[model samples]
Target: MVNWFWKRKRPLTRTLRVRSRGDYGDVRRVDFAELAPEIDTYLGQAAYLQLGFFETLSDLIAPTPELSQKESLSLAAGAALLKHRALVDVIRERGDDPLDVMLPFREPLDTFRRATHGARPLETMLSVQITAGMLDDFYLALSASYGATGKQVAEILQADDDRDALVSILKDAIDSDPEWSSLLALWGRRLVGDTLLIARAALGSQALDEEEEARVDPVFTDLLGAHSRRMAQLGLDA
Candidate 1:
């Protein structure tokens, strides 16, 4: 991932408006400097992240006892897989091997997945909902920097994730046990820092100067706003 943020300070005026599409209604206009990873890096990370989401959701299916819940999770998993394939196709169109592009990110992202995983199934489900939602919004914002490829990536991400079913399942769990409300809320809060780190890392920088922070803040602010709504919808306080 090449650093797109030049160290020199400059007054930031660039803005990217992420239009609401499909079930991606929460994405909004955000102002940020022109910052993005290299196209291969962007496509690789985005592609693998979707694959991770699919794997996490699919893993949950076998342990899930309810047939309806299994089917719902399956749908969401399938959506993630479809997005992954779409992204990989884009990589191929660019003449890059998907595996090579994605390889460099595998370990760090896998570590991230393990860190976000929960001891219980419901908690893990919330992890997926909150984390995936935040990262998707982040990618949508970053997609604007890549021109035609960005548009293609944005379209793939905007497709209905079918995660609403997971939300319903979570709501049912909370309704049955009020305790879930607090537990999941706590887990959701814990996810923010880690997810934000991943978002920042995607910018290919480990640290940002004050000017850089100012430029990047609005994008993160929008991400958090959308994140809070997602938590609230699931009856969890973020």
Candidate 2:
């Protein structure tokens, strides 16, 4: 298990603009030196995280009884695997062995996967949608720091996740049983802490000094805002 620690300081009122090129064909960019990691660190973590999502989604397929649902899960799983492979190509183009770059992150991220896995399949499905959405946004924000390579990564992250099926599946679950509405909502809320910790940890530190925190705060704020919108889209309270 990954031990989690978070400290809340008073929010700072500031506007930081990040131009995102890959999301919805928007070609804008911003660089954050204080929060960005070395290029290898960023690439390795992003690649492995996508691979992890693929593995989780793949695991969900067999036990799922409905053929149409299985097909939907396969699409989402394939998208995740495609993103993972695309990231690996980026790593290879840099002349680094993909495994060498990705190895260090395996244990911690696997721990993160386990920690976020839920008691039921629906809870786990929401975990993939929410965590993947937030982290994909986080990495896209960090992509600007790496210039052209970052742009390529941004494009990869922005690819269609085909996770809308998961959303419809969840919404149906909630609508079918009023009980699922509260259960999944609570699961969604519980996910934020662990998910944020994974995002924070990817910055190459378990702890950040106050100055670093200040610079990183707005990016995370944006992540949380996107997260809430995703939860609401599922008809659940964030």
Candidate 3:
């Protein structure tokens, strides 16, 4: 039932650069103190969105003993809440108003959610997964561009416990209904596309270099590769 949409002919490891020291040589160093407000803005909105998504997911999943004991849906929701609080804490520590920091991004994030509303729990989970993974890549890519605090926030935002739980649920769902593989695969693709569009719009508003913009396509290709691998792991076609 695994239908691969495309296969990468060559490896992409070298194509997509992470936080390598060499890449930072010519790049202008972003002052953490100056950038802290914007950083908090980004993370706060992200934390709010993720927490809401996890809360909705917690309500959607059936309370089976296996799911209850192992995944503990409430734990995922709680984790997301805590992450939001932590983001707020980061903002407060920087002496910024958390509400003001997150206010600008609220509209775009809401619009994204409204535009990409899923019809099923599986699709919802996949959307979360795609967004989470892409954000991780984006943060990691830009980690060195900012200062040490930026790196710290990037690492903090990279937590994937809730996403991991969603993945387990997705795998189990696919296993139970192999016939849904094709549909789910299509959903995954849609999620990836929508996520990228939203990300582009969001990050485009930031001050990025021409070099960074040029590097986006290759990094996105790497994201697709990672998404494909994740789909394959769930016995779905990429």
Candidate 4:
């Protein structure tokens, strides 16, 4: 069942507004040591989510006989696995147990998956694009606030192959059936709504400070802008 919240048609900026100030937060510098634990936890959840996405993709592609399509799917899944391993390695290097760090997130992530489970291939792809893109944007914000280590992990997490592949598939699908464009645009909106809701619930649990809260609107704006660009790239309404 789709959540009622996913049906909301509010603009992203309005939905994600942290406060009425509309002022961007100054990028406060943070050392790796200061944010290490939080970063580790965030990366662990990200790694787990990526692996889950691959598993979902793998299942979807399993019965397909097209070699080229299979190859692309495999490559995307392989990239996700590589990202997972990199995140785990970083967590271990930080002297933290990766499993322990990710444990708290399992429930929320699982809930998100269940809530946003797509009924169609295009819907699934849009969900993947929105979820992965939002995570990347969040990491980018962290990288800017934190130092070199955060930057390194953000860079490592930055892989557009899967998104690019999905976009191609979406474009082909929509082009073949022009009527699909409208449906997909709606699906994309639902995906974005659900994703942001899940993100807010997860991050809200982390108890962000005043400055961190102040950063929310700007990061959300960046994310929404990226989503718009992606939708435009695929010839879908943002």
Candidate 5:
């Protein structure tokens, strides 16, 4: 009888893995009727939709106090969402990591520039990307070295200063002593971050501009002509 019971019986198990903490799939489902500010629900749901998973960076590593935690999480979540959206859009277009698409096409573009000798459209694209790269670098340097305070970085970028003078200052400081290496590294990182910020800001400005249609309305017909002329001059095809 013991053998029969043991053979017939089976162990029972029950468990559920909850992947999300929120009730809404998107913005509209949130209940805004409560008297309290709904920023948590609003931001949290946006974060989940963008990331597919959510965790506070602080809590993931350390014991953060309750008072400032949510705000800090929301700030990171906002930046992450922007990154995710940009990456997804680029990946959809190129079937590769967004970095491959978004990075300034310097070497290839420079080669084409040298071969073609200052052709108009190629030059325009090169100029834009160069400016974008500079902005990205600036932001990166300031962020990593100076605590990532957006306002302070913005003030630095917005300051009216000569680029040549800044470069000279940086180079002199670097050559002055070995101790300056850390400062130089920080400066280099800020320049990279600034370049990224430039590209994204330009992307946003163009996205919002009413004049966008004036260029895109023709469906990039002239772009093909510019591209073919430039590529042919460089002896590149396909």
Candidate 6:
């Protein structure tokens, strides 16, 4: 979680904060005092202009799944932050295929980008951590409901000494909520755990926090259900 990055010039000729994050909530703390100009500079780039693509994606989502558009956007925004922020160096260190690893949730992402993101560029959107928090809350609820219990779900929040024990405590969060979980067809494995990995990083990064239990955003659940349904058409195991 280092915060010292080699300041490479941006292709867009914009200056965005190249944050060096640590394991603690140690990202370059939200420094509004020093950020306005930098954020504006990043937003001024052509990449920012491409955010209109999300509007088109929004239309593609139709009524926008079971989650409210806001909720979906929250989740999507989290996903974006994970990609752009989070434990980025480790991901890069692994030399993992970003497309294969992260883009599995493309449908939802594309839908989210189209619906939200407006004229903000990716660099600008990801520079701030508050937005990542919004997304973190959205991801925890969405991922846990898929039937992963507390023990399996513990990493979403704290770092437990006995991860196995904490996972046991987390079963409720993963098991009882059928709202979003019902839409997911859990088999023996996941074709897309990286989506959740992004969320875990967001949670650890303090970019997300949990909402009250029983707060099931129906719009999101329905959308997830729709996402699950469509997967069946391709004969892909849900």
Winning model by lDDT = 1
Q: TM-score of the candidate numbered 6? A: 0.22
Candidate 5's displacement at residue 69, Å, is: 44
Candidate 1 lDDT, 83-112, residue by residue in tens: 999999999999999999898888878888
lDDT of 6 by residue, 175-229 (tens): 5654323322332013223233332222222222234111222323332343344
Q: Superpose all Cα atoms of candidate 2 onto the true structure and report the RMSD in Å to 1 decimal.
A: 5.0
Candidate 4's TM-score: 0.76
Q: Model 6, which residues run further than 4 Å from truth?
A: 1-86, 92-95, 117-133, 140-238
Worst 10 residues of 4 by lDDT: 6-15
RMSD of each: 4.3, 5.0, 9.2, 7.9, 24.1, 19.2
Candidates sorted on TM-score, descending: 1, 2, 4, 3, 6, 5
What is the C-alpha lDDT profile of model 3 across 1-238, one tens digit per residue? 1111211122112222344221121222322212222455445655666656565556555734464534555666666666677667777887888787777666666666655556876676676666656655555554544466565666666564455676777787888988677888888777776676655543423454566565565555655676677777678777
lDDT pick, better of 1 and 4: 1
lDDT of 4 by residue, 100-177 (tens): 877777766777776666787667767776677666555545554335666667667665445467777778889999
lDDT at 66 for candidate 3? Answer: 69
**Residue by residue across 147-215, what tens digits does model 2's lDDT show?**
689889989988899998999999988989999999999999999998998888766556778877877
Query: How would you order the candidates by lDDT, starting with the best?
Result: 1, 2, 4, 3, 5, 6
- The TM-score leader among the candidates is 1
Candidate 1 off by > 4 Å: 1-34
Point out where model 4 deviates above 4 Å. 1-37, 63-65, 202-214
Weakest lDDT window of 10 consecutive positions for candidate 3: 1-10
